[model samples]
Target: MATTSESEPTTVETPGSDDQSREGEIFDLLSNQRRRYAIHYCKREDDPVTLGELAEHVAAWELDKEVAAITSAERKRVYTSLQQTHLPTLERADMIEFDDRTIELTDEAAELDVYLDVVPADSIPWGTYYLGLAAVGSVVMAGLWLEIVPTEAVPELGWATLVFALFAVSAVVHVVQNRRMRLGEMERPP
Candidate 1:
């Protein structure tokens, strides 16, 4: 065994520590709506965006107004917050490159695309929709098993095929919608 001095420090690398840390950082960055909007704007732009332009659009989005209609005070408030807090945080996370008032997304920002699915407040979650579909299928199967409907009208194989088709169609639509909802995938942020 090697002798160790009390003053020496040992660093151990734990499996998945980097992943866990990265996940933590991502969640923390996304916790704020302003940061989310900033990321959204960056993703939508092919070229690096000036901080002033970022602030104007963010203010417009937050205020639910056109960019020209946004008051100076509103723009200033969002600008200060992003400059002092959100942008720096994003820069440190390596999700964005910030330099000399210009902002651009890094490769890590693309990784965040999967997490940016925007589910509207009024819409049902995908999980609930799938559950309802399953329940309806089960009920129909039960009815068929009980012979409530004539087998002459629809055979067991036909019912099974119809159910399978329904699920397959719904899954395809769900995937398409999810892709549309991801950041930068659409003309507007979802």
Candidate 2:
């Protein structure tokens, strides 16, 4: 006869539970402005910049290659972030090769850098721009659609003007609704 014997517990440990660190792995891959700058600095350097120099360089950071000067404390954070956080995580993914002296992106990482690599400072999604255009189009289209002047009746100037004004009001409503849709504020009722 088959019998129920025992059940093992499922223990979820925050650390040392798995061979990988998910949070670290992700942060390594999705580099922000500062992290990318660190990588760029390493790639461009002919020699290893000391932690102090790196720290200094990071402080006066204006995203300029020809920066004026570096500060003392900024160098420390740069070095620590580069070492404990950036270098090890990148090394695991083969994004960069690290030795005692320095760290740099691997040939593969550099080559693959062309795709989904870094977010440019000025980059803006085209969807937002197109949506703004759509708002303007809705207004113009609504105006033309109203057709205040009926060819059959040939209404008097005052009546036609009043109708045109009403049409213009409708156009304004169209523009407002379009704006809401573009912003994802339109709700579907259940």
lDDT of 2 by residue, 114-190 (tens): 33322224744334544655666565455445764354554455554655666577668556544443211222100
Model 1 regions lying over 4 Å from their true place: 1-14, 142-149
> What range of 10 consecutive residues in model 2 has the weakest lDDT sum?
181-190
Segments in model 2 whose C-alpha atoms lie over 4 Å from true places: 1-28, 31-33, 42-55, 62-68, 107-125, 141-190
Clashing pairs in 2: 55-74, 55-75, 56-70, 56-71
TM-score, candidate number 2: 0.43
What is the TM-score of candidate 1?
0.87
Each model's Cα RMSD: 2.5, 13.8
Clashing residue pairs in all predictions, respectively, total: 0, 4
What overall lDDT goes with each candidate model? 0.87, 0.51
